[model samples]
Target: MKKSILLMTITTITLTGFISGCSRDYTPTAEATGEDIFKGACMECHDAIEGKENIFYELTADNKNIEFFSKKISGGSLLMPKFPNITADKLKAVSQYALDHSADK
Candidate 1:
C-alpha cells in the first residue's frame, strides 16, 4: 500500500510538471516597439545596430532613410535570416530605430 501510494505521488508530480512545461502555441506575437524587435532579432547577430566596427557592417549604407533599413531588414542578407513576420509598422519602427542609432547619428 505504501509503495503504491509513493508511485502514484511520483507519477502525479511528473505529469504535472510535464503538462505545465509544455507550450502548444506555435506563433509568437510581434513586439510593439522597434527597439524591441531590434533586440529580439537584429541584436543576436549585429550586436550593435549602430557604431559597428566591422568593415562589412559599414557598407550597409543606410542612405539616411527608413526605406533602406526596411529593405535590408525584411529582405535579409547572406548570414541574416529574413523577418517575414514583422508587420509594416514594426518594420518602419525598427528601421527608424536603426537610423536614429546609427554611427553617424
Candidate 2:
C-alpha cells in the first residue's frame, strides 16, 4: 500500500510539472503604424520619384483627410494599384502617413 501511494504521488507531481511546462504565456502585440504599412507596401513604388516629380504630391495634399485617403487607396487610380485586401484601419494609417510625408514636400 505504501509503495502504491508513493508511485501515485510521483506520478501526480510529474503530471503537474508537465502540465505547467506545456502552458504558454501569450502577450498581445501593438498594432502597426502608418509608416510601417507605407514602407511595407508603398515604398516599393513611391519611395523615389524622378527629379522629385511626384504626381501624387498635389493629390495627396488635396485629399489629406482619412475618408478621402481610404477611398483613394481602396479604389485605386489609373496609376495607383488597387489594394482590395487591405483592411480599413491599415488604409487609414497609410493614408495619414502619405499626407504627412506630402506636407514635407
Candidate 3:
C-alpha cells in the first residue's frame, strides 16, 4: 500500500511537470512603424486627395500644424477614412510625422 501511494504521487508530479514543459511560450510581434503602416494603407487614398486643387492647396498651407491634423487623421472626418485598426500609439506617431513632414507651401 505504501509503495503504491508513493508511486502514484511521483507519477502525478512527473506528469504535471512534463505537461507544463510542453506548453508553448507565446510572444507577440513588435508593433509596426507609422511610416510603414501609412505606406501600406493610407497612401492609396491620400495621394489622390492631395492631388486635388483647392484641398491640396489648403492642406499644404496648414500641413505642419499637428493639432489641426492629428485628430483628422486618427478619427477621420469628411472624405478621410478613420484608421480605427491602428493602435493609438502608432496613430499618434503617424499623425505627428504627417503634420511635421507635410508638403511645404
CA lDDT of every candidate: 0.62, 0.60, 0.55
Strongest candidate by lDDT? 1
Q: Candidate 2, residues 30-56: lDDT per residue as tens digits?
A: 477877766665655565445564333
Off by over 4 Å in 1: 1-31, 49-62
Which prediction has the highest TM-score against the true structure? 1
Query: What is the lDDT for 81 in model 3?
Result: 51
Show model 2 residue runs off by greater than 4 Å: 1-30, 48-56
Q: What residue pairs are clashing in model 2?
A: none
Please write out the lDDT profile of model 1 over residues 76-104, one tens digit for every residue.
65444557766578788878877776654
Q: What TM-score does prediction 1 earn?
A: 0.56
Which runs of model 3 end up more than 4 angstroms from their true locations?
1-29, 48-63
Give per-model TM-scores.
0.56, 0.53, 0.50
How well is each residue in 19-92 modelled by candidate 3, as lDDT tens digits?
Answer: 44321222112566656655555655455335653222235555457656657755666455555565567666
Q: Give the TM-score of candidate 3.
A: 0.50
